[model samples]
Target: MRGLVWDGSELALVDDLLHRPPGPGEVVVEIATAGLCHSDLNPIDGKITQEVPVVLGHEAVGRIVERGPGVRLPIGTRVVLSVFRPCGACEHCRAGRRTACRRTAEPAATPFSRDGLPVQQFVRTGAFAERTVVSQSQAIPIPEELPDAEAAMLGCATVTAFGAVEERARVRRGETVLVVGAGGIGLNVVLAARAAGAGRIIVCDRNPRKHDIAVACGATDFFVTPEASDVAKACLDTVPDGADAAFECVGRADLLNATIASLGWGGRAVIVGLPSADTELSLRIRSLFHDKALLGCRMGSVDPRTALPELARRALAGEFSLTPLVTRVAPPSEAGDLIADLRRGELERGFFDLRGV
Candidate 1:
């Protein structure tokens, strides 16, 4: 197996490796494609803290080559890898909110080994290599028609955007929606809000280059913001009363504040971005008392098994263009350079293709 590994301070590729078979209630997937996301780089670059010697990857799609007991998926099934493992018996899972499961972390599970030492699996999917192991419930079957490259995105970006607008916010028709940041995740938000029937969808970003992409993804309007106050005013002007809902996808405290302020009374704000650890945002308590709600979304708050299929259906129906968001594809060895580029804001919409290994 060849995959990228991150030590506490450095990252490297380990080409000589072996992954153990799936244990009971687990499935072994031969990864065909994986999307390199900023989240993976955050930990490696020390922007986010985590354990070291970890295999870094979460958004992926692969073929199930082996299945253990209690796993219903057959060998050779195409599946999207979900990193979040929900305890089926937990209160949150029982209430149909698997993403909010009380016991979300099920670490100490090994999917990679080198020289007989187990390596940590980042986000639990560990799809940066040829094969990986995941709990049976974490593997969502994808239709055979979708390409593996596109299906890989369902694990995070697409599903997060779909679930946030549809399930978390329950965005209705005729609602005015504002999505902050026009990155890969933000573009998905734009598309999802459009599909949800938002009458006015406005996407805000500091990059002028993303304005075109944002509009193509169904943003009715785009705002380039260096001044949060001006952006808020512009968004309100576009909707007059203010946006019915705002989604913060940049994970910056300042942008979060703007998203909160841009929402109309009774409007809901969903924060889908993964912010830095221990970060905080100040708020005006009195303003929020007017029924303005701030909501935190984790991977869109929907079951991937259900949402991924629906996204695929929409894509097949020509409702969204995966190609527009795919700006770059590189081999696994370029992880270091990719991380550096992402940190420097050089990447727009992109993903790395790992099959080159």
Candidate 2:
């Protein structure tokens, strides 16, 4: 199999990558499409550390090609692969907080190998390759009506956006919402907020080119700015009394602080971006005194098994459109360039078609 491998120093396309057969409770998915996310860039750029060499991609949609014992999902069923693989025995999982499953932090068994040596999967689903194996629970089935590229996004961006707005922030009808970073996740946040019946949806991004899509995604107002302070100022300028809920989709400490500062009394700020492991945040003690909350969201606090199907249903019902959020689709050979385009804020969302890889 061919895969884009990150060998600690750089990403390279390798043709000899191999994956082991699925173990009990797992399934092998022949990846159709994989969404390139900012999270995939973290380890490559040193924003976060991971054991490498590894295949880097998690947001994927594919069809079950093989199944290990105990897996009930039939072969050829289309599904969205998720990074969140919760061990049902854990305390958090037992309490229905599957997103906080402690075992998720433990090292996952490397399924892919290069030259007979172990290669890790980014999270548990390395969908950048032609095929990848994952726990049965990590594969969430979707309707046939959902296109492969769009369904792939439900694995991460869309699920996270819906979770942030409906679960974490509990956004009420007619509330004012502010979102930072108009990339894949940010635009989805606009969609989620709009679906939550928000009165004002304000979005800020460094690229002016994203303004049109941001508005099309349901942003009532859009601001083109790069600085965190400037983004906050722009958000406040649009909603004078401060936003009722704020979501920072760009994982930067300064931006999170600005998000916190741009909230009204009793407002909630949800952190959706993944920051560097060593990054530290500075906060104004007084800013959080007005019942303001700074909430951390892990994978949008979503349980993929349940959340994905509902999102697919909503997509089928014309509740939200995923096509507009996608900026471009290319083959696995263009992974590096697409990632660079993403880092430069040049794409809203990019997908890798892995059908024949």
lDDT for each of the candidates? 0.82, 0.90
What TM-score would candidate 2 get against the native? 0.97
Candidate 1 lDDT, 1-357, residue by residue in tens: 888888787788789768888898899888878887778878765776677788888898888899888888889988899878888897778887788886666675677878888787887887788788899888888888877667887788989988899988899999999999887788889988988889999988888878888888898899888766766877987887888889989888888888888889899999988888888888888768778899988889887767788888888777876767766677878877777766665665455676648
Alpha-carbon shift of residue 118 in model 2 (angstroms): 1.1
**Which window of 10 residues has the lowest lDDT sum in candidate 1?**
343-352
- Model 2, 1-357: lDDT tens digits are 899899998888889999999999999999999999998988888877688899999999999999999999999999999887889787888777888887865667988998889999998888899999999888989999988889999999999999999999999999999999888999999999999999999998888999899999999898887788897799788887898999999889999998998999999999998788888998879999999999999888977778899999999899999999888999988987898899888888899999886
Candidate 2 local distance difference test against the native:
0.90
How many steric clashes between backbone atoms does each model show? 0, 0
Model 2: residues >4 Å from true position, as ranges? none
